[model samples]
Target: MSEKEAETPGKRTRPGPRKVTPKYLENAALFYLQRFATSAANLRRVLMRKVERSARFHGTDPAEGAQWVDALIARFVASQLLDDALYAESRAQSLRRRGASGRTIALSLRQKGVEGEIIDTAMAAADEAEEKPELAAAARLARKRRLGPWRAAEGRREARERDLAALARAGFSYDVALAVIDAEGPADLEGEGSL
Candidate 1:
């Protein structure tokens, strides 16, 4: 039998013996944040999960680990290393740039544990900078997917209905979708109101 298969249930797969110290947890948090953008709650969840896993392996009290996780998160927040507002703003801008609609951006930030007020502020900022975020996002999507005006003239006629439905499903309003689909060029999309 392979070594893994021969191992007893008590000797299962794990990341070796790890001492779950406060410093270790802090290092873990820093490493995670460095590699990925995450909200405060999400970071807490990740650290807590690590604590639970370590407790299970080492037969230690999870309560102590929980306290360490809380302390570390508090410190990170106080030091300005973990700002939910900044994270939300960055995430919203990324979503908008990727052609996501306003509704989609809000829902995504909510899923990431951002508050509604923060989401509204970020989206408002994006709106002010772009002058009609949803409309611009719709146009970007059309251009990227080669839908609407981006589609060849002969194919545009055939793809009109499908393109409209695609935009609707992507959280765009019918009016914006129709306008983008009927736009003759990029300037047309820019001049049209989002409504």
Candidate 2:
């Protein structure tokens, strides 16, 4: 093999990211959107990372790439292909079902680049969709993790404090955690016509 093509032990060479252009950014954005839901700010960050990589490898002007990103984001928002509110609401609901606390959900949405106002709205919508959302979420978490009342009677006493701590770390309030941990059985929580 030629010296240039020769491989170092335990190392493999791969091509750098493609050069950034308006069309390239648009295509990348569309491809990304098709595969995952994202907020506009998150999408901007993703596109900008590509621009930075291209700037490094191809000497592309980052300022020009950023302008293209701004225009692309604006177009996507106009087309309703990128909706932060919708993304936040859907993500919040999914997380709630998996036992995420309200605070956890809000923090998660923020990390995804959703605005605080939009996060609040999404959280409110999630709460409206369920009665006692926090309680339900805590119960779901207890059941999934086999904590609290879900544990076998023989072990429940010994594991009570640990179970409460788990719920606490999962973002449940003391009252909610205590309620779930002190329940008689799963039926007590789920039989109230809420899951």
Candidate 3:
């Protein structure tokens, strides 16, 4: 082996990330927004992480990066490119469709840095969009996990308590869990037009 190649370790050291600038932060934010719906705070968090990484590797000032992030976020919000209310509502609906209870959806939105008021509004919207939203969500969960009515006849009776527990753990109330778990069949859940 050549002395230059042999002198190096088996693994090559990758270059550090580029120093964060306003333009770089803007580009990163735009790219992120293009792929995922996010609240202003969540987007800020993502961009700040990039800033922090660059600061650690390139000795850049995080405070400067933070200022850039703040300005970029403000600009996006002003342009209506970042709408927390819309994000929360859309996310709540999507989560509900995937069997997430209202409580679960609220918690998820909170973790994403959405305000409580906005989460409440979003949840109300979700509720208005469906009758007995919790029950519907529970039903969807049961169907997806093959619990309760979706289970085979032979084992359903034996797994009754387990099915209820699963729904309970998924942020469903006891009443909702029982209703879904004790359902006679998938058709029973659809009686309320919730399915």
- Candidate models: Cα lDDT each: 0.86, 0.92, 0.92
Candidate 2's clash total is 0
> lDDT at 27 for candidate 2?
93
Clashing pairs in 2: none
The residue pairs that clash in candidate 1, if any, are none
Q: Residue 87 lDDT in model 1? A: 92
Using TM-score, rank the candidates from best to worst.
3, 2, 1
- Model 1 misplacement above 4 A: 1-19, 192-195
Score every model by TM-score: 0.85, 0.92, 0.93
Model 3 weakest lDDT span, ten residues long = 186-195
Give one clash count per candidate, in the order shown: 0, 0, 0
* Per-residue lDDT of candidate 3, residues 1-195 (tens digit): 567767986967567887899998899899999999999999999999999999999999999999999999999999999999999999999999889988899999999999999999999997787768899889988999999999999999999999999999999999999999998999999864356
What lDDT tens digits, residue by residue, belong to model 1 across residues 1-195?
567768765665545547688988999999999999988888999888888878888877899999999898899999988998999899888888878899899999898888999999988876776767788899988888989988988888899999999999899999989989988866688553332
RMSD of 3: 2.7
Model 2 spans with C-alpha error above 4 angstroms: 1-12, 191-193
lDDT of 2 by residue, 154-191 (tens): 99999999999999999999999999999999999995
Error of 3 at 169 (Å): 1.2
Candidate 2 Cα lDDT to native: 0.92
Candidate 2 differs from the real structure by a C-alpha RMSD in angstroms, to one decimal, of 2.3
